[model samples]
Target: MAKTIFITGASRGFGRIWAEAFLERGDQVVVTSRKGSGLSELVEKYGSAVLPLELDITNRAACFSALEKAKSHFGRVDVVINNAAMGVVGMVEELGEQESRDIIEANLFGTLWITQAALPILRAQGSGHILQLSSALGVYTFPSVGIYSASKFAVEGFSEALSLETKDMGIHVTIVEPNGFSTDFTASTIQSKPLPAYDQVRTALYSNPAMTESDTYGDPKATAAAILKLVDATNPPLRLFLGKKALPLAKAVYQQRLASWEEWNTVAIEAHGL
Candidate 1:
């Protein structure tokens, strides 16, 4: 049984890796790139099994049209990977209007548009899975990555709600949270103009062991194998963490969160007046 996977941002990094994995296994894929860099190679290698589209997912109409074309070309999309997103490297106060807007537009809204476009097709078919590319930053945060993490946090919020909303429709939503990977993701992140006032703050964050990976960055190729198992599973999780660091980071973050919430529960309970 071959699956039809429609993935955005297939020009590089995790997208390219995953797309190749699918093609190697005889799965047909509809892969999109913003500037149209990665698609040609996929088509050259896989022939008609790869449908390449030039897409800027930030454009809402284009997203809908792309999805429609994929459905028309492939007849059905078994998996929709909303993996096209951008990151802005900035402290919250260091961010400018354009920097904040670009990150939010590409990461949050682009994801929303694609998810919206895919829903009807999945609904009609009564089966589908959506993989939302989020980050460990979505679960926690770092100072310099406030804007980037905010975008991921927003992604996590809606995706969790979406998982619940679509479960009965046979449409599964999974948020893919990857810790720091040895991909160009970090290098490619758009940098906001520096604020000298926050130099020490930024320095401290960058100096932390966790910031630069207490362990080495995870291998990007490993992710492709994980998702192969993921999409093939009958019961998949709503949240899946990639890389070795995510689980430990999540546990530490959640434990601290639980402790704080428990400590503050008295005020919360009193406010409810029950």
Candidate 2:
């Protein structure tokens, strides 16, 4: 059956690819981007099958308004993709208050606003799916991406709590953690003020094989396909990891965390029932 998908940040990168994939499969897509650059071509190609909206998702009011327009235009939104996000790369100290605020506003709160706005629509219909675009860094942080990772980490926690809370309402929520992908994401990333002392670490981070995978950015199309599969599944996992690099790294980080918790179990028990 055909469905309607509302995707934010659809002008480029993963969001654009997902929009195109849905359109190709005959699904109605409500696509929004800050400037609607990529959406223009999609509109030309898919015609009425796609609805392009100019959106700056960081604005809470704008987010609600855009979603309202989407629901009104499409009749109902079966799936909401909270894919609008901006990346910030820098040491924590290097990022000023405004820089931190900018990233948090676009990536974390943007997603929250969309999800909050979409929930009521889905509840009234009694069925819906929400896919949040997190990142591998959400589970495991990387140097220079502290703020970006923090935003994603916030999304992960919010999405998890949302999933648990909405299951009774016939609404599904999934957090998508994708690894490095072949997109303009790196080039488009916002950088914090540089510190001369941090240059060595920053340079090493940028030159790392994982970061230098510029030539081998994972295919967004493949990740999009996996996403569609998750959306269509009867019981999809709460968290979906995309790309080859994400799984092992996430597993390793989680394993290490678990070991530490176990190692400190005595301390935890000692504090309990105090």
Best by TM-score: 1
* C-alpha TM-score for every candidate: 0.96, 0.95
What C-alpha lDDT does candidate 2 achieve relative to the native structure? 0.88
Worst 10 residues of 1 by lDDT: 208-217
**TM-score (C-alpha) between model 1 and the true structure:** 0.96
Report how far residue 120 has shifted in candidate 2, in Å.
Answer: 0.6
TM-score of 2: 0.95
**1-274 per-residue lDDT for model 2 (tens digits):** 9999999988888888888889999999999988877778998999999999998888788888988998899899999999888888789879989879988998999999999989989999999999999998899997888999999999999899999999999899999888888787865588788999999998888788866766446877787789789889887789988888888877898999999999999999999967
Give the Å shift of residue 85 in candidate 1.
0.8
Which residue pairs in candidate 2 collide? none
1-274 per-residue lDDT for model 1 (tens digits): 9999999999899999999999999999999989888589889989999999999999999999999999999999999999888878778888899879888999999999999999999999999999999998898987888888889999999999999999999999899999888887764578889989999998898788766754658889989999999999899999999988889878998999999999999999999986
Off by over 4 Å in 1: none
Alpha carbon lDDT of each predicted model: 0.91, 0.88
lDDT against true structure, model 1: 0.91
Q: Which residue pairs in candidate 1 have backbone atoms (N, alpha carbon, C) closer than 3 angstroms, thus clashing?
A: none
